[model samples]
Target: MNWIILIIAGLFETGFATCLGKAQETEGRESLYWWFGFGSCLFVSMFLMYKSISGENAIPIGTAYAVWTGIGAVGGVLAGIFIFSEPATFWRIFFVITLIASVVGLKAVSS
Candidate 1:
């Protein structure tokens, strides 16, 4: 259950980061929404990560964190492309897949 919460929190870290990126493009009141959302997610993620680390040793915690971040990065890029319509090129997709695979491989080895 703790690990699950940690993973969820880590995903939220990506969410906040992506929200920050989106907020940067906007102006005035609408930007506030994104900024607030980003901050809230950031806080929650950190708290959850702290809980994870407290529950587990450094190695597993670190490995899980790295994997989570990698997943988040891929998710963020996809969200940007689809939600923001930033860009969606073949190379980008390839890199994202590579990153995902690398994370999975790391998790497998660590486990």
Candidate 2:
């Protein structure tokens, strides 16, 4: 359950990043709206992360954080490619795959 919450929080991290990117490409009220989205996602993401570390058998902070940022980083790159049409080069995709493996490995070894 904590892992699920962690994953959701990481996804919200992606949401905030994507919103910030959207905000960058807009202006005036439109940009403000994106910023609002960014803020909302940020809050939710942070709150979830905090929640994930609670309870008796909470995840070690180091592992939890690494997984959280791992998900966020991978999601960010994918968002940049799909949503923002950033480059989908070989090396980028390769690294993304490796990062995903690393994140999953972190989960597999964690208890």
Candidate 3:
């Protein structure tokens, strides 16, 4: 359950990143709304992270943080490609896949 929370946190991290990107590309009320979304997602992500690391089943901070950022990084890259229409270059995809594998590897080796 802690692991699940961590994953959700990471997804919210991605949400914040996406919102920031969208905010950058807009203006007026729309941009303000995106900024609001960014703040909300950031808050949720941080709260979930704290929950994942603070209880009886708490994940080790080192491993949990790595996985959290790894998931966020991968999701951000994919979102950039699909949602923001950023480059889908070979190296970008390659690194993203490796990041995913590393995240899985971290999870596999943890308690």
The Cα local distance difference test for each model comes to 0.80, 0.95, 0.95
Off by over 4 Å in 2: none
lDDT of 1 by residue, 1-111 (tens): 655776687688888988899799999999999999999989988887777667544436767678668867887888889888988899999999999888878757863
- Candidate 2: RMSD to truth: 0.7
**Residue 63, candidate 3: C-alpha displacement in angstroms:** 0.7
- What are the per-residue Cα lDDT tens digits for candidate 3 across 67-106? 9999889989999999999999999999999999999999
Task: Sort by lDDT, best first.
Answer: 3, 2, 1
**Residue 100 lDDT in model 1?**
86
Q: Could you tell which candidate, 1 or 2, scores higher by lDDT?
A: 2
TM-score of each: 0.83, 0.97, 0.98
Model 3 misplaced stretches (Cα beyond 4 Å): none
Stretches > 4 Å off in candidate 1: 56-59
Query: Backbone clashes in each candidate structure, one number apiece?
Result: 0, 0, 0
